[model samples]
Target: MFKKFVLATSLAAMALSGAHAAEITFDEAIAGATVFEFDGDGDMVVDVRFGTDDPEGFNTVGPGANQTYISEPGLEGTTLLDTDLFVEFLGGAVGTLSFGFATIDPDTSVNFTVYDDNDNVLGSTTALATFDTGGDFPEALASVSFAGLASYATFDFFGVGSRYIIDNFNGTFGSTEDRTPDAVPVPGALALFAPVAAGLFARRRKAKK
Candidate 1:
């Protein structure tokens, strides 16, 4: 009985190990998606909130040198002025974050604000992401690292009348997958195995009596 319990627990641990810091390259078929969620650990979750500034929201834009990337098309009849993305980490925090971004105009800039778990501002930065003649809009990368763990972050396009796109999200948290439209939550495998292990323990105790 003990051996069976140990085996079940080990299998569940392996499943949980699958959750790790993930980098999103925007290579998947996420043409018309909005919210991207990543299961970092069994207890926490990470969400890259996007698609709030334009009519097209978050969609694949081009097949440039870097292939397809995510962007918000500020089409007509839209009040959207600037492109923005919010990365929120729930139940946990990270110390490092990086991603690639680009703008419609050359020599555009982007602004970032990072916060801690208590909603306190940790640091802010402005990165200049230029348009490459050969690569796509996401040709330049923006990276940030702080001494304290970060709970959330905000990125905004600072160029006047210009929009931006992002791709290749690298972080120090868990990994993620292409979640088009909606993403279903997946906790650690231990949640599933816990019940089985408990049942087995109960049976073993009864037999011992």
Candidate 2:
């Protein structure tokens, strides 16, 4: 019965988020492919322009850490505008992009703005950055998902200093990725009735007996 209850809740949460997910870890990014405009070399990524500095080059550290992590190169303070990265999908708008995140202080500080093919803002939210304190760089993989069909998304790593990195992007765009939401957040309406549903289930069981 306990297993069944957990399964039901997980399913409910996925149904509520309302977006198909996709992810990528720079590991699969073509080593010499031009994914970023600034990365003239074969670096895993190019800088998206953060506070007058665009750091290019990524590193891998931690347990089984074979993925790439692009860290901000300069010390630009602890504000949201210090670090930025632009992820341009090969195919325009391949669902929402999410990944594991990490930062210097290991705090919840970052923001995101998504755009369509024409560089129009599809949506902006403060919910994109989730801090996952696991790994040598303190990784948090896609604690937040930017929902929609987007050409690309700009992620700003803001916190008490801009020493940030991301890895294990799990979403719809890459191979060896899981589009399935194992434990997505439950939607608002469903969240409200969680306790009520449990109570109702209890009542139904009592009546059945």
Per-model TM values vs. the true structure: 0.55, 0.46
Model 1 clash tally?
Answer: 6
lDDT of 1 by residue, 79-155 (tens): 13443667775433455567666666566676777887787887777777654435555345677766566667877
Itemize residue pairs with steric clashes in candidate 1: 20-174, 20-175, 21-173, 21-174, 22-174, 22-175
Task: Go through the candidates in order and give each one's C-alpha lDDT.
Answer: 0.55, 0.47
Q: Which candidate ranks first by TM-score, i.e. highest?
A: 1
Candidate 2: worst 10 consecutive residues by lDDT? 32-41
Tell me the tens digit of each residue's lDDT in model 2 across 107-161: 5555666676788876655532333333344444444444444566676776554
Candidate 2 wrong stretches, greater than 4 Å: 1-22, 28-56, 63-83, 125-148, 174-209
Candidate 1 positional error at 170, Å:
0.7
- Candidate 1 Cα errors over 4 Å, as ranges: 1-21, 39-55, 66-83, 131-138, 175-209
CA error at residue 111 for candidate 2, angstroms: 1.2
